[model samples]
Target: MEEWTVKVNHCAVKKEKPQTDQLEFGRIFTDHMFVMDYSEPLGWHDARIVPYQPLTIDPSAMIFHYGQSVFEGLKAYQTPEGTIQLFRPEKNLQRLNRSNDRLCIPAIDEAFILEALKQLIYLDKEWIPSAEGTSLYIRPFIISTEPYIGVAPSHQYKFVIILSPVGAYYKEGINPVKIAVENHYVRAVKGGTGEAKTGGNYASSLKAQETCSQKGFAQVLWLDGVEKKYIEEVGSMNVFFKINGKVYTPMLNGSILEGVTRNSVIQLLKHWNIPVIEEKLSMEKLYQAYLDGELEEAFGTGTAAVISPIGQLSWEDKDLMINNGTTGELAKSLYTTLTNIQYGKEADPFHWVEKVSEAYAVK
Candidate 1:
């Protein structure tokens, strides 16, 4: 693929800044954006950076009607050396194409997209937050833009990448969050679009998320769509389990999001000789492990919250508490290892972090 034509158009004003001390996730955005269009005749053209503004789409856009859209979430960290770098962005690009393949959306060449993103982020380097517990959040998405309602794949599509300067996910600092084990509603089904990071999957979970919020939980612990006995994942994140002296996560069974963080933790655990297994983990066995003192801890891993320890898992009138109602030792180990590599504090044995150099936004 040839280099994507890059143009810098800056936003006029910053959206009301969130208190850097109270940075909430996904709330504050930068001043510039990168967008490209694709049509059956002209694939991926008009790649440009424009002012961060509300998008205008036709009422009959495919995204609004037949639900053809996919997205990715990752972050740009301000390294200790003061350079902005992305954490394993190639993995994200790979997953984006997986989603594209699932949704019948044409693939944007990964290297081409990465260069465009680097060029765009270089232009918005100033937007990369430097304060402790703050960094630039990157959201890249694609929508079927053909103005029609027939429900077939759209002839036109739009791909956009936007950056948001965000503070830490928790204003109170990195603390353990309570999660509820959902028994009734399933997040994704077997042989479905469960693994794809499409907007519809997220939209289907809003009600469940609301229920979790109402019940005073941070997120919902989803199980297999059919069996409903085994573990799956959390909202847009993958789940990890620490049982007895071993670490376990549900194997990638074509129904769960394969998180980059999850893979990183598994690699680091192996590096330390910590026995880690990826297999089907049943909720029945999970609760039994807790009762037998075999289940020591649990947590969810993703780009948004990093490795968030699950302090409590409540379900079916059964409440299982994880180690003193606070952060687990395993959680701390994984978090430190992952973030250390991310911020360049430790050697990246997996070569995951990708550094961004030179700016592209037309300043």
Candidate 2:
């Protein structure tokens, strides 16, 4: 592993930490963050741990114009024994590299970055919240920093990791939420940046999300960008449907994000001997399942929500009430099992959690 410099924030007055109960998603940040620079000749270098502060970027940076950036989200949970651990963090880093490949950005050393992240988390270990439904949110991102206006990949870039103590992604927590099916605005098309964890895919969805929010929907369920028939994702999470004791999620068709939680959910289902299928699921078919009373459950899975039940899905101005507008038994079980594994409350049969040792921090 590479040796990175560490600069502790020894300011006279430290920033006040928010109460775990009052913590909002991605709002309150820790005292320190991890940063690394990348240039054409030097590659990724100047890795350091410094105090949390804003970056001084050039006004003409490529990221500001061409939108060449990629990011990954994960969480660090504090166990009951006061040990900090991460849930499938390596998967997130691997996905980040996949996103980098799509964005024409230089690949990062995932092992080294994970080590640097562990060191950063260990340095700010106090920020890890122990409250139920709360964990330290980790945002690892890379941005093009070369100050150029040409429509091409930048030569300079910055990779940063910041931590935030968050309660729940949605204000409803694990409760069911109403979703509006997006028919007008398309999130991404096949052979686009949908599969990659990039910002442009999200930025394009905000307008539709905002439109649905005003209609009292928590989020918008995006359909396929080309034919607009098959389901792609729900808001920032991958969605799944349960019909007649079988689980189904949209297959990765180059337009859907392969979520870590989604994969875990499928694995857990298979572990329990439940039939789970990933295929092209259309809204009409799902509605028919609901009409036939076979739609047992619906939910969205992501690092933030873990498992968010879909109480109602509005499509074509008609509402499809799922599970009587309540959380399903399977959804609840998945949430409990995943959260327990993350917090070390249950035995991790899959060995997904990685503990962060104090030795990672630089003295």
Candidate 3:
């Protein structure tokens, strides 16, 4: 992989480090970021790492009007052995390209951008939180920069990467969360940008999420837009259910985000010789399982939360509780296993953790 040029921040102003316990997700940013530009014929150029600052773009940039943007989230962990590592970063890059294709953004050179990311991470490696359950959140995004907004794809764009030291997704730790099944509003339909990590899909979900929040729910479990019968996913994570000693999740039906943690959960389950299935799971079937006392547990998987146990699921005015509204055995095991590998507490048999060596840490 080709290297990205580094421009040291001569006027670097380091902020006072917040107490680890006071750390919030996406609240505090590091001192530097990686940036690259794109334009017709020129392609991606002028890649460099610069001090974190406000961006200056045309007010009429297409991103402000047409919503031509995409983003990806991943984390860098400070291992117990004092090494910094990332989990399945290539998968995030691959998904970023998929999102770029869907949003008419030019595809980036995966290897090159990944190398650039590592360089950026190494430069800001100290920003990675060392507290338990804390890590550096990485946000890589692209936005349309073309000034003209005549309802066409932008010819110019900007790709940027920023880092934030995050504590944890849930303050309650890996406890169970309450979810409200959305029936009135749909997040995305088939043949839409559901699979892509674009801002529009998330923006369209805020109303539903707001409604669910007012009802004392943490997130909304989205059903398919067409029939509204089959389960799709949570607002920000892929969902899984354990019924009668078997695990099942909604299949990728062109309307679901393929989460890296979701895939890891499936692989870990299969590795343990547990039966797992990916298919269209209906809310009716889920409710029936609950009534029959077969629904053992449920959880949501994502890069942010990693493993969030779902204890209460409200659908059609019925509050169905799983595992007595507590984190189940399987959910706890999966969380422990996944975090162990991420924090270097155990051997990474899956080879998911990639190290950012100290050599690259020096500018």
How much is 238 displaced in model 2, in angstroms? 0.2
Off by over 4 Å in 2: 1-12, 169-173
Query: TM-score ranking from best to worst?
Result: 3, 2, 1
Q: Which candidate number would show the highest TM-score if scored against the true structure?
A: 3
- lDDT ranking, high to low: 2, 3, 1
Candidate topping lDDT: 2
The positional error of residue 67 in candidate 3, measured at the CA in angstroms, is: 0.5
Root-mean-square deviation of candidate 2: 1.5
Query: lDDT for every model?
Result: 0.85, 0.92, 0.91
- Can you write out model 2's per-residue Cα lDDT over 1-363, one digit (the tens) per residue? 456554455335558989867898888898988889999799988888888899999999999999999999999999899999999999999999999999999999989888889989998888888877789999999999999999999999999999999985555556899999999999999999999999999999989989999999999999998888999999999999999999999999998999999999999999999999999999999999999999999999999889999999999968899999999999999999999999999999999999999789767
Per-model RMSD to reference:
1.8, 1.5, 1.3
- Give per-residue CA lDDT, model 3, range 58-166, as digits (tens): 9999999999999999999998888999999999999999999999999999888888899889888778889898999999999999999699999999999999999
Residues 59-176, candidate 1: write the lDDT tens digits: 9898898899999988888887897778999999999999999999999889988988888788778777777667888999999999999979888999999888887665565688
Q: Model 3, stretches more than 4 Å misplaced?
A: 1-11, 170-172
How much is the lDDT of residue 265 in candidate 2? 99
| Model 1 regions more than 4 Å off | 10-19, 359-363
